[model samples]
Target: MTVTASARAASPLLDLVRPARPTHVVDVGANPIDGDPPYRGMLAAGLCRVTGFEPQPDALDELKRRKGPHETYLPDALGDGGTHTLHVAATSGMTSLFRPDTNRLGLFNGFSEWGRVREEVQISTRRLDDVEEVDAFDLLKIDIQGAELMVFEGGRRKLAEAVAVHTEVSFVPLYENQPVFGDVDQELRGQGFIPHAFAAVKRWPIAPVVFGGDFRQARHQLLEADVVYVRDFGHPESMTDEQLKQLALVAHHVYDSTDLAYHCLSQLSLRGLAVPDAPNRFLAVLGSANRT
Candidate 1:
């Protein structure tokens, strides 16, 4: 799912009005396997400046060539500034910092061979607190396969600057000893990042078998999902107008979070910083789209 900038540019859904100040992002494990990453949308709108991290050499090279003026890709993985082995898989998307829980994964269909680790490469890991390019960022987007918690563990202090986090979380232990959804939720709550919304969920059938149009009986099991965490939603007044505006753009453009967009728009409007006619129109578009 390689996303070209041109293809994304064609989609004005994310080209919502830019904020007064740039929305900064600290993206960890920013491998572009999951289609065009949200940072691209934020970048195109000139609403964000991103400092991304990716250890995969090929992916890093590709990013290096295509990175925009507001983007920077570091070839370091986020961790305790130590040497770690990457569990490379048969497919690039399944690679992770943790070993695969092959037994549990083999119970499913397309996911059975997802964690076929082909190689293990030693890599250097650095903590986000040590990075000079990042003073603070509004969003902290991470997708380091199963090591999402480890990154946060290493940079708990730095996370205080983040208002929102969009990260991948496994509902089951797809990888051995990996933190599950509960673990992630607890950690984020401890950091003051409340569960905002689920951007995506990857599920597999309960059992691999032919069904005679009895899909409801077959049932499905949750595998992994992209989870969104946000700072106190009740305390929007604590945020400046520009920060609220940046959050609004991120909510609408990156997450397609119309509800959050409405919240931000409301706050901005109350402070006389509305984005022209965005609040009402965003609601209208969402209403019409969901109706069908």
Candidate 2:
């Protein structure tokens, strides 16, 4: 469920941890092919600001057309600051820097058709650190198909201050030379983040076979997922007070992980950084929300 202003208002715990400025979010591959983003609630509630990058012309136009006051959309391809050929797939969401691996995709249902390259465009890319408009942000939400590692490699300095990251990790390589989940995990962990939870998981059945007459339903074969990671929460001493506050807000508002939010509050209280009853009030707020 998208967390609304009423939800934020009801949570006295959120009030205690709310930062002076809105949470800043940097979205790479900000195409609207998918429905509302995970941070939609925070965006609607005026609790966050979004700076989105989409190189696809049609996608960029759509984003600009519906952009809100707190949103900024840019038409820049983000990578390792080098020119590369973008494989524009039949499905916009499938488009990526790497070409589709037809052999692997043919093994699954409906993927080969969708991953077919409709066009190939050569584009110059910008590194995240080189972008003058992009500064320190609280959250990083990226889904650039198979090129996520390029962003991470080029933006280490920019990501140092980030409190949380929501990224699409693939268990199976859908694109040629794609870095799978393990690769992304190692990089994120090196940057001081621990895997928190998966927001969504996708599965696909093998081609020429249907499960109970349903092609969409798969009993096994995990394909991809949107994984949420946060700055190492176990060590409160490593995070600043502001980082704790931002993380608490993202946990509660974006991911609905109230326990994680409460943990942040408890750590704050331990350091005399928050009210003594902050954690208790958070539980009370959660209880009230559940009842209603």
TM-scores, all candidates, are 0.79, 0.94
- Angstrom error of the Cα, residue 134, model 2: value is 1.5
Per-residue lDDT tens digits for candidate 1, residues 119-176, read 9998877777777767767899898878888778777877876778998988778788
- Segments in model 2 whose C-alpha atoms lie over 4 Å from true places: 1-11
Q: Pick the candidate with the highest TM-score.
A: 2
Per-residue lDDT over 2-21 for candidate 2, one digit per residue giving the tens place of the 0 to 100 score: 33577567445557775656
lDDT of 1: 0.75
Instruction: Please list the residue runs of candidate 1 whose C-alpha ends up more than 4 Å from where it truly belongs after superposition.
Output: 1-20, 210-219, 237-242, 268-292
Query: What local lDDT does model 2 show for residue 234?
Result: 84
What C-alpha lDDT values do all the predictions have? 0.75, 0.89
Give lDDT for model 2.
0.89
